[model samples]
Target: MPKKGTRIVCFSPKSSSKSNSVTKFSAPSRFGLSPKRPSFSQSVMDRTLELAKPVITKWNPETTTFAKVTSLFHESRGEAKDFIKCVHNLQKAMHLLVTENPTSDNLAVAQNLMQISMRRLQKEFYQILSMNRAHLDPESVSTRSSRTSIQSNSTSDYDDDDEDVDEVRVAGDSIVQVEDESSLAMADLKLIAECMISSGYAKECLKIYKIIRKSIIDEGIFRLGMEKFGSFSSHKNKKKNMDWEVLDMRTKNWLDAVKVAVKTLFNGERILCDHVFAVSESIRESCFTDISKEGALILFGFPEYVVRNSSKKVPPEKVFRMLDMYTAIANYWPEIESIFSFESSLPVKSQAITSLTKISEYVRTALAEFETAIQKDNSKSIVAGGGIHHLTIDSMNYLSLLADYSNILSPILADSPGDLPESSESPAPAISRRFAQLILSLLAKLDGEAKLYRDVSISYLFLANNHQYVVVKVCTSNLKYLLGDDWLSKQEFKVTQFAANYERLAWSHVIESLPENPAAILSPENARECFKRFNASFEQAHRKQSACVVPDCKLRDDIIKVNLLRKVLPVYREFYNKYRAKMGNERSIVRFTPEDVGRYLSDLLFGNVGSRSSSSSNQSSPHSRAPQSKTSF
Candidate 1:
């Protein structure tokens, strides 16, 4: 009925005359009117289309269960299975139609049905993704992926040819089990994905997948409190002006978020993408990159932003947070590398590495700033009683806490040695060397603080107090391990040296006032004068030294007291006993017997002990004269 070269229009069963849906087929050859037997190939092609049409039309997006606002895969597994099987059959029919009967009228019908089927599958894919978001969440999907992998590996000994068939059969059988909804959803998605991709609608399938899954990831990151630092126009201004309390909270949140993002969020997406698009490596990588790359960049980029936007002088406390970020990235590098292994995902990897590099640089800079702070401390107020300087306590506390992170700082300091002095006495790790340098700088600052004291004896006491405190702090904490026993021993010796300096400056004049030889007899006037000089010097030294403090009992008893007793006690005792007899009734002029002198020395340097008043001294020696002049040391 149609002319040569004319086209015959084929419409879907649901199409009306007003519908634009139509497929065109060229008119068959005019010579085909001769009643000839159909070839075996033609019969097979016809049979293929006959078998595929009912399932294809039944599951069509317009007239079938797919049109309803329900997940086809979730509502009925049997129907979902039939739908996938129908698509496979339709693909076979298309292959046969193209090869055996390119111009057959039924070819146009098959083409039309195939398009409808793919649209339905696309809709179902989107619905499953949207409706089961919680089930398909990263944590759930990751767990299912692990379980699926174990099952696959356990049955791998089966023939490779049966693997695909077995996978489909297993997916169907598992749908009836009381499996978790996430596992069912995952298997259904994978099944539909393979079917659509094999049927040449990969673009449509991937588009819907990326749209839905990427949104889920973006929303998940939002819920996890990952902010997009790039959205701000002035990172430097934002960070510089931001309150540290707020920034610290954000940094802590970032730390928590990054772990979830990498280990669970991105990892699950990678698994789901791989499983769904298992037939094509390229598709899997591309899909996963599209779904997770932006979120990952924002997540990892937070640390870099914090570091880069920081004021030129980041607080020393900020270094600890920076180290936290650095340690996080370093600890999870294997996961990051594995998850973002694709070339397309390299930006994410680069962002994480850049964060690490920038954080390390900032940690080094912040530490250098901390050292400079110690070096530049200019407070002039001396600690009363020559106790430890405030600067010493603060610096040592900071260093001891810093030492807690030595495992983290070791590599960082090693990378940029800076101007940190290397110890020639022994080979120390870079962090140890840096710690040693920092402590030395603090000691130098304490030395400068020591000069603020007017009394030379008090200055020596100040140095001794601070140095002993430093040694105690180092020996008690992780610093002891970093700065080895040799260094510790050397520091301990320095403490002793300071203590000795204090002892000598405080008591040398008192010892000198006694006779060179206690047995050397002199004139009675010389005897009275010797007693006068001894009383003047001993009272002056005892009163002044008693006001000073030795906080550490060990240093007081073992070092300062021992050195003083060994140097002053025996000499003073001999002078007192020899002179007490010569002074006669004026023995009270001696003012202190050997017992009194030893007791006073024992009480020296305990800060709590008050100076002996003139009234109390006079009461002890009722007849002793008030000295004609005050002694100076």
Candidate 2:
């Protein structure tokens, strides 16, 4: 301290380490003998470090201490700006101290404090977003008078920040009376976004970024650094001086945020909500820009918009939503084409078709998974089975509508993997033929599933029920248009075949006692023996088959009373009446008259077997040949 111009400065150690440390410096000696004179750079560094000390020393990152940050945002007049000011000062001080003393232990403490400050700011931003989600309608924000109206209301009710604080709006959409306001707004957003990024809250940063970009677009500001619409300054009309660089940076952030949102939306575990729709719509809107116009469908909004990571597990819901979104886009092809037509672009249709192929792959994958589960343990499957059944019906209806409305399905069905013919003159039959093939494949899988049951009667009954449902749906619904008249008749024929199979499996023994030519069997001993066998067989079939489960009540009645009984009872009556008198002394052996047979048959299958008079004169059964099985003889 020999020189008169010397200055004494005290430097403190890191907050977590020794706190009170001193550093001394003196100017160059006048005698010109001292070599360690502090340089101009050293003096400036010393001043900045000293200025940062108090902030570092008093840094308290506890949530309770920072709780006021969020409170100030919600409760203060300046919104995020008020909160940003306090935390930003500390952050700036920390940065200066760290930059000056890079290797010092105190620098680490400063960095830690900076991180805490950033996280606190990010936490507050999220709170604001969550609180204001419902109020974030674009139309409301776009209206010029909305903010002033909000301000008027908020001013009367609260002492703190107005309720409508930080309501995001585009620059030109509303005229703010105050000058340099948009620039200030952008500065605050950039600082807050930096804090968000440092805090590991990429998602929060994206929300702010989206707002900024939307503002840029709404304000009619040039975002891509090009002037196709006009010079950036021309739109300003020299009314308000604006910083184009800030807009440029915000545009970059917006693009980056879109990439992040795409990856997030592809996650299956998360529900597809309004947030997802909003992000998707924004990205889709951005596609028409010169920067993305060329490969917009491929690069931003289609099947290969983002490169898929195959190793990660994608949820089915995510794929389903992607399909739904692509379908929506495809439906809007004409409109999108009209806009992009100036560029000579026809990518929407081709890209949309690619997306449909991807959707088909997902459908195939789901079906495979379902089939595998069924194969593993068919009895344990309830929800999956029922879901697939419903999916089949719904998918058919959906595909039919797609075909009828747009010619979209025609290409898909025509190019659908392998089974369909090469070309067809009629679109309806082509789609029908392909869909029928798919349904047949599903039915075959279901048939195999039914056979897994240990009870043969139940197995056949299950097949009957499913087959009947499908046939009925095809006959009555729009499916008839696609499947054609011949397809409907075939399905009906299949239904009849299933009915015969169910009867053959459940009641063949009952019908076997009737002779091929019952009139030829006239001997008393033979007729008595045949009558006894008929009664025993009928009783056995009735007891076993009655307990079988048919979940659909209407189907149960149709198969049993209307279809099977009508085909069996009249034949039973002819055999019984012819044999009743032939059993002379063994008349007591004739347990049931034709009337009793009819009543018992109806009562076993359904609850009511009609009146005795109604039963005695039976309606003729359909002349169906007995199914070819050993039990049918």
Candidate 3:
């Protein structure tokens, strides 16, 4: 008899019955001689049929309950084992009969018996597969594959002694019993499949498997909420009709679906295919490709369809979703390659690569459009006090979020050449160059917006405010990593330069009103005229600056205020003390004491801080003046 799991090839019978050769045999000399003993081939055939017929007949689909709701393996493992053993023996018998009695009546009988046995195994194979749907589901099968590996490795570490064997068996028994049933079902299917394929019934066996399992995979993909993109009528029309909100939701669903499909759905089917057709590499590959190819194509094809069906004028906001899909494919590529490893599965692999390429293209296109949008911004409304522009806020916000995807975008940007210069100092050079270019475009646009301010000083303040806002945004987020310390330091220095320009333009004439040397002892007449010029310049500078605003507290207090005090205060104090006494009765010409100048400077740059009072009291006493005290100056 053939050993279990061995393939037995059936040979075609030779047509010996048609030969014209004649044989003559001498009649036995003794009349009482026993009739010619049965031929060895004849006895072998008789014994093989007797052993195979009863078991094969008992398990016949039409005659037994095995074809009904019962699983042969689950109903009685002994009978199942006996059935498989009989099929193997029947195949062996067929091989021998074909070789020994190629034209005998016994060969025909053995061939017919072999057919009956294979039919029985085929029915059992389909029945077990149908019955064990849940136990053999992809997720469960994937789990089983891992557990099986662990169990096999664990079993190998033990000695072959009976005590060690029993310990291993008991430990196995402690596992979830459902897995054991799944293992038994898989083993039985493998046995039947091997027997049928070895016996030349592979076509029938593969037909049944492909039909049943392919449906399961299709349904599995559908249940996971993957939609068929072809159902949409026209890619362009679909893109125009579908709003961003709907596409966004679908993209999210695809993200979820692809992970499960690769990790559990296609992967599980691959494992099951490899196990059932373990005896044939070609069959395993063919089966897996047939079972998983269509679904995987659809799964991987989703992102490309999304790119096609998205508006050609893709929204800047949608780039992240595109990157998300790209990252998902890139992240799970190894598993996809392993599961669909067959040469026949190249289309599925190609589809995945195409999707990644398409998504990267979409991201690059979206980024280019975003930069163009920033450059072409043409809002006419001026910011009230040369504060941060709305364009600046929006552009910085978009760039900051883009920085969050630096790792994903790095390779994508590297592949697409850009007009921007590369910075080796950056961690992700391609992304950093692109970000810097976009920022430059935004700053250029902001420069135009700053011109809307009537006061040159306020224009400087607007640039300073917006630049400081951009620097802060970069410093606080992932943009810091991509843009690097050098970029940040330069941006910060630009902010300081802007602030200095504002200070010079707004207050230069006021500081210049005082003498280059404040201790110069001018005659009383010259002192009074000097005091008059100094008071006029100081009040004009204060009233104008009071209306302007700075948004950042650190920029307003630490940088702007500190710089103003350092440059203007000490000089005014020395000029005031020497000149106030010389003014004599013309004390009103020294309208602002050194103390009053300090008080007014504190309120500058906070928008409209004292504008109304300064205007109303111009002819009256200076409203910002503290009570006169020689001790205060």
Q: Which candidate comes out best when scored by TM-score?
A: 3
Query: Candidates' TM-scores?
Result: 0.81, 0.41, 0.84
Better of 1 and 3 by lDDT: 3
Candidate 3, run of 10 with poorest lDDT: 154-163
lDDT against the true structure, each candidate: 0.73, 0.45, 0.75
Ranking by lDDT: 3, 1, 2
User: What TM-score does candidate 2 get on C-alpha atoms?
Assistant: 0.41
Model 1: lDDT to the true structure = 0.73
Q: Which parts of model 1 are misplaced by more than 4 Å?
A: 1-37, 64-71, 145-179, 228-230, 234-240, 415-427, 512-534, 566-587, 593-599, 611-633
Question: What are the RMSDs of all candidates, in order?
Answer: 8.4, 21.3, 6.7
For model 2, what is the C-alpha lDDT against the true structure? 0.45
Off by over 4 Å in 2: 1-320, 341-414, 420-434, 450-461, 476-479, 514-527, 549-568, 571-596, 603-633
Q: How well is each residue in 1-633 modelled by candidate 2, as lDDT tens digits?
A: 011221111234223333233344456567876556443324434444455444422332354564544343444435445444444344444444444554555445444544555555555545544444323323223222322232233221111343222444334336653322432232233345444443344445565445533343332222332222222334445433224344334334434433322222111101111122222333323322332243234322333321121212343223344344445545655544443443334554455456556655654454344334334433433221111244444444444444343244454445443232324345444556666666666577667766666667656666666666676666656666666676666666775676667778777777777676766756777777877887777667765654454445666666667766666667766777786666665544665555555544544433222322352323211112111221111
TM-score: model 3 vs. ground truth? 0.84
In candidate 3, which residue pairs get closer than 3 Å at backbone N, Cα or C atoms, i.e. clash?
Answer: none
Candidate 2 lDDT for residue 295: 27
